[model samples]
Target: MAICKILFFLLALCIWCGKCDVFYKQVGDEVSMKCGVDSNSNIEWKFNGVLILTIDGKSGNRRKGLSHIVLKASASGDILKVPRLETRDSGNYFCRQSGKQHIVHVVSVFVKPGPVLLQSSDAELHCDITGDPNKEVQWLRPNGQTYNEKNQVIHLKSVTSNEAGQWTCLVKDDLKLSVTLTVVGLQTTAVNASKGDDIELPCSLPQSVFQRVVGGTWKAGHLPKVSFPTLTNTPSKILHWNGKDLSKVNFTTGQLSTNFDVTLKNVQSTDEGTFVCTVEFDGEVRLSVETTLRVVDKHSGKTKQHLGCTLFIRTLSFILYGLKLWIWIAVGASSVFLIGLIIVIGVVIQRNKRMKKRVRKLRSMRQPLTDKDYCQCINSSYNNCYSVIEVLQHLFF
Candidate 1:
């Protein structure tokens, strides 16, 4: 009986060692592998080629373990179980039966994080990672503040002058990775001024800050570096003087002034050039803005007066010429009408005289027949009679 029991145990061990199989499956999926001792015969299961599990009334040592997953094995030999598989669960696994051995599986799964935008007004930065395991993300500010939030995204609420600096993002996992986020500030206003006048160019800050005026310096036409002196009780209003002599330019208010305003008294035409404003802050000189000053003569007033006078003279000349043209036309028309009237009058007078002479000649041709008619006709000589008749006719007509 003892020998028979030992032989039965040896036969069972051989059957359990003979069945081994391995295969691959995706994460969050069911896993199953065939375990058989012989053809048309069920067998037990072994994990990693050593431990065994029984199936179909066969018994063996049951084993269960996990690398990065929950491993579960039934007393049944044909199946090995894994629950809630992850990226780290991807690896070699083994299954066993009677006398056959096979690699159970090698699994590979992928997972990726969403894209994120790290942006500023002057610069753009991005951070992304792709793998089976989620990556840890971090961001560092120029002020030495570290941010390690797990939202797959990070956004700056608003960019300010103080936020203008280098930023870094660190991704930690099986492999460590890093990216940079650069935040730059935007300039809202441009600097400008006129020559021979007091000018105050303001450098705008973010709206959050209460103070409107910030500290800044002046650079003149690519000249050498000159520090901006502090404002004091005496000559503090003038930031810089570019004229011939600094002593002549009055700055009783000292060098620096509040409100970033520069005053120039008695500014001259020669003090015209480009001026650059630079502000030192946040451990370095960040921004350099430029403006220009030009001295121009006040000729607009004179030009306007001259133009007004010229227009008045032109208008007067036009009126006079129009009047002269009208006078000449009137004189010409009167002369022509007068000459025609004189010729017509003379013709009419000559016609009347001729008619009178013809009438006298006709009268002279007539002969006297009776004594009374002869006496009436002999009252004057022929020429005298004709003249007297014409005179009478002229008076009567």
Candidate 2:
């Protein structure tokens, strides 16, 4: 009876010690829990409240009383095992001996997706997550499958309109924490051509957003394909169409007095069509304005011909009038000259006749002088002779 009493006391002491000690641990790490009891003390082990191992004796008949199970106990009957870890390897574990019940120690093990690296034709995209413990990152397709390594980069090779869409990245941790990554594909704006006899179509992107773009693409209606032209220090001014094909039309000069002007040289009737002007910055279109052109026939040639005819008639009349006036003056001057010449000739002829009459009168007067002289001379000379003769004649008569 005294020996039975001592065994009872030892059993009670073991039970009390097992229930006193309990602890916890995290997953993917080691699990070390101890139930402090003297090495000389008899003990047992229970996992999850189930009796699995115990120390008892019936002499060499230890096999009949939980001896077949090996319980590698520490000097203190402490339990330590690295529970071959898995996501489900988390729960309460316990160690008990005799009629004593010990509360099981517990730990939580969580599993999450790992970091993902995505590759694309042009560039690369790195995916990651942040949490208490860094979470797992994954790249997924729309179908919920992992993305191919080559398709990871943000910039895809030979980007086309069809290659435009949304991309996603998913992140998760043991706590079921999740994050979403959104990637938007680049887009191209529409370019419009103005309608008119001669039209200017404008291609421009928004100023604020355009600076971010590296380059853009352009297209026209029912025309052969042409790529977008890059803009330099000078932006592309205008786009034009010759009757045959589309052309990179520019202003006659680099600048324009008007908003945007393109002069058509020798504009033909067919030149009356729409013109488009597209301005690009960076790699995007920015601003656009459309203008209509109407071509009208000018009457310049007809007006000039009319003016020339009028001038010719006026000049001809003036010349004829001048000639008539000149002829009248000449006739008057000739009449006056002829009259003066006749008067001068008549005066000269009258003076010559008078001179001839005076010369005849002088010549006629000398004859009478000669007769008187002869008479005197004869009388004087005869006087002497007459006395003698007169005496003789008187005697004779």
Q: Which number leads on lDDT? A: 1
Candidate 1 backbone clash number: 27
For residues 1-397, could you state the per-residue lDDT of candidate 1 as single tens digits?
4533433444345457654333333444455544444433445444333344443433343333432233443433354565554433333334333445443222331111111111222223344331212334566666768765643345554345465555555443322233433333223233222334554434323222211123354556533432333222224333432333343233334343223334434445655566565543322324455666554443556645765575555554453545754466677899999999999999999999998988777667655446544323464656545755665565556
Query: How much is 387 displaced in model 1, in angstroms?
Result: 87
For every model shown, what is its TM-score relative to the native structure? 0.25, 0.23
Candidate 2 vs. true structure, TM-score: 0.23
List candidate 2 segments past 4 Å from native. Answer: 1-123, 129-136, 142-145, 150-155, 173-196, 205-230, 233-397
* lDDT tens readout by residue for model 2, 139-187: 5544466656522133334233333233454432332222232222222
| Model 1, global lDDT | 0.43
